[model samples]
Target: AELEIERWKNENAPPNLPELKEHLQTKKTAFVLQEKRLKRLRLLIDSNKFAEARSEISQWKKTGEDLSGLSEMILNLEHIEKSDDIVLDLKRGLAWQKYPDSYIQNLKMAVDRCKSIQSIPRKSFNWRIPSKDELLLFFTSNIESKVQYNSGSYWSSTTDKVWSDYNWIVESKSSSLVRTLKDDYKFVICVTDASSEMIYHYLDTLKF
Candidate 1:
């Protein structure tokens, strides 16, 4: 029967081999991503980190990512948290994950280490300081009252290539864009791809 099925597949093969190959490659790429997710889920389950696994599943659902077998996995585990609740917890986190490291110094170091958490949400947060433009927008936006940060300047991803010693920051008091030494102590908030409401909720509680 398997041999007959192979014969049937061969007979149905497209004449455009290049296009067929491209299609097959796309499927393979998707399959690889799915496999990684499954592996991560399994590891989480085995390690008994059910909340994190649920969080991952919720994040995927929020982003509309394909969750091929995740629902079944959750069922198998007897996880009682409703999908809505799981999503709510994630929303509470702002989907803005605080890195395990409380404080990190220097822009280069922050960039290098922050990439490690990409596997959590199955997407990279791309931990970066807000740009001057982004910071200005944040301050001027209607959510300004809700938006809060530490008492001093926080680093912005913007850098002065000409002046290698300085980096830009958003001043907390005036919301003015200014330059400062990267070596200074400044609170950091990683970026997130959370939903609009989640993002707004996050901006309200942002802290050092």
Candidate 2:
């Protein structure tokens, strides 16, 4: 009778028990690690180490971790930062950031950093190199003459459609439009529509 009952229990047991156990263990381990990370991030935030916290989140994303909850929290923090930003308004429904250089100096890095803001439109620019004609006309205009700015080379978003590797450029000293390779990094000045939030989060770290 004992032997018969043992055989019955075995037959009724769930199939693939080993696989299920492995999967459950994997999930448990992941949960534990996630909890540890969450605690660390919270500590970082409380300590006013937001940059480190943001860097940690970025590292996790690069590792392909599911960070939706953390990302949402960070977004809330960014919103607070945005509200505190010094947004400058200009004529003709235009907005400009007070500082010229971006937190990340490279063109691609600048663009990518600009794109991270959810409060603003997608692919929003904090700075861009003005077009040759635009820069020329701008500097030549009475309005530009009144404003004191240094003459330098700046990066423009205008890329040659026919040549994917080339981009248009403007020199503050002259009005001619020039073409350059995409890899060359140059100075950038950002502008936005009047409605944009124009948050420059890294500006606080800058001395100027």
Candidate 3:
């Protein structure tokens, strides 16, 4: 009699478990569809399809769809493009033909200022001044020459040819020679103000 009562109860119970399972499956499908849509939007933006990407965003907005991911993607793409544009502009400006005459002159003036700040010391008695050949060789090899003698003072010549005329005279001594060179000669036909240290550093940085 107890077994029969148990069986009857089981038969009469409502079948709600299948309904709950179906609802959960439907939610999973919707989540997957949203993820795919977001991925496509990102791809479009990355490929520079801004118009189509923007249109998709508009549709999402009208449908009251969540688009936090898509909006962030678009913002990131725009930022990357802006940064690239600035870098391209600087590169183009550095090219001899691309820069305006006034800009080049300004750059030269800045270099001159850096040179004025450099230190120059008289040659010591023991160490000899480099000869013209030696100077040329040093310049070609891209090496700065420093002469230290028994006296407490030492003299240094930048290997750059810009100061070759003033080469005999001691000029600026700051280690940041490249910045000086760039600032002084960016616009000049002859980069006479460039320092050996600057040229060496520039070449070394290039691994050339």
Candidate 4:
């Protein structure tokens, strides 16, 4: 639950990666399903059917569904992307994630959520907070038009050399990168390997 805001000097430190592909597969599948369920609940709330909405959620509780992410998802409904697609940018060799434990978090938490999705099979790719340059690739006019990406200021793993506590973030609105405190709350988009083999591996493992 604790997202670590990395010190500037430790920007290149290795991430905590999930070794079991099966675990990653199971977790990703459940998360995608839960997101679908929440979207339906979101529609109910939008329609102002408060009682009906609460009743639907009661069923989830009875079925032992994990509602730990419920509060954050429901409260931040507007900012969260509706698409559950795991996008692959072949040119960059990166596969992007649409969901996070919370859409908005401090730099540390955002990176932690990304690291949770990393899988190390025979051919490995680690997920972590993208660097400023990596994130810039997403903010481009051409890429923006093609990808179903989340729109907002996003924290980057790249940090300042001198400032030590400052980090870079991309503001989607202005399409610019700026320095800010590591503790600042911002959105996240996690990326991992999108190699040819990894692509097939992801679809087969996660059942895309």
TM-score, per-candidate, Cα-based: 0.40, 0.40, 0.30, 0.49
- Which regions of candidate 3 are displaced past 4 Å? 1-15, 61-76, 79-85, 88-208
Cα lDDT of model 1 by residue, 1-208, tens digit:
3344446566875466556666767777776876676568667655657667667666542334344344333432333222221111233222232223455467666555555544333332233455666656555554334434445566677887788888887775787887788777666544433333322243234221
Task: Point out where model 2 deviates above 4 Å.
Answer: 1-91, 102-104, 113-137, 142-150, 195-208
Residue pairs with backbone atoms closer than 3 Å in model 3 (clashes): 111-183, 111-184, 118-172, 118-173, 119-173, 159-196, 160-196, 162-192, 178-198
- lDDT for predicted candidate 4 compared with the true structure: 0.61
Compared with the true structure, model 1 gives a TM-score of 0.40
lDDT of 4 at 198: 34
Candidate 2 local lDDT, 1-208, one digit each (tens): 3344446566874565556666767777776876676668667766646667777777653444344444444544443345433243333334333444432245675565445444443333333444554555554554454433456666677778899888776676775677877787766655444321222232122221
Candidate with best lDDT: 4
**Candidate 2 TM-score to native:** 0.40
lDDT of 4 by residue, 1-208 (tens): 1122234224653344333444566777777876776677666756645456556666663344344334223322211223244555657756566443345899888877877763322124567788899889877735456555567888889999889899999998787989999998898877665443332332233321
Clashing pairs in 1: none
Per-residue error (Å), model 1, residue 53: 19
Model 3 quality (TM-score): 0.30
- Residue 109, candidate 4: how far off, in angstroms? 0.5
- Each model's lDDT comes to 0.51, 0.52, 0.35, 0.61
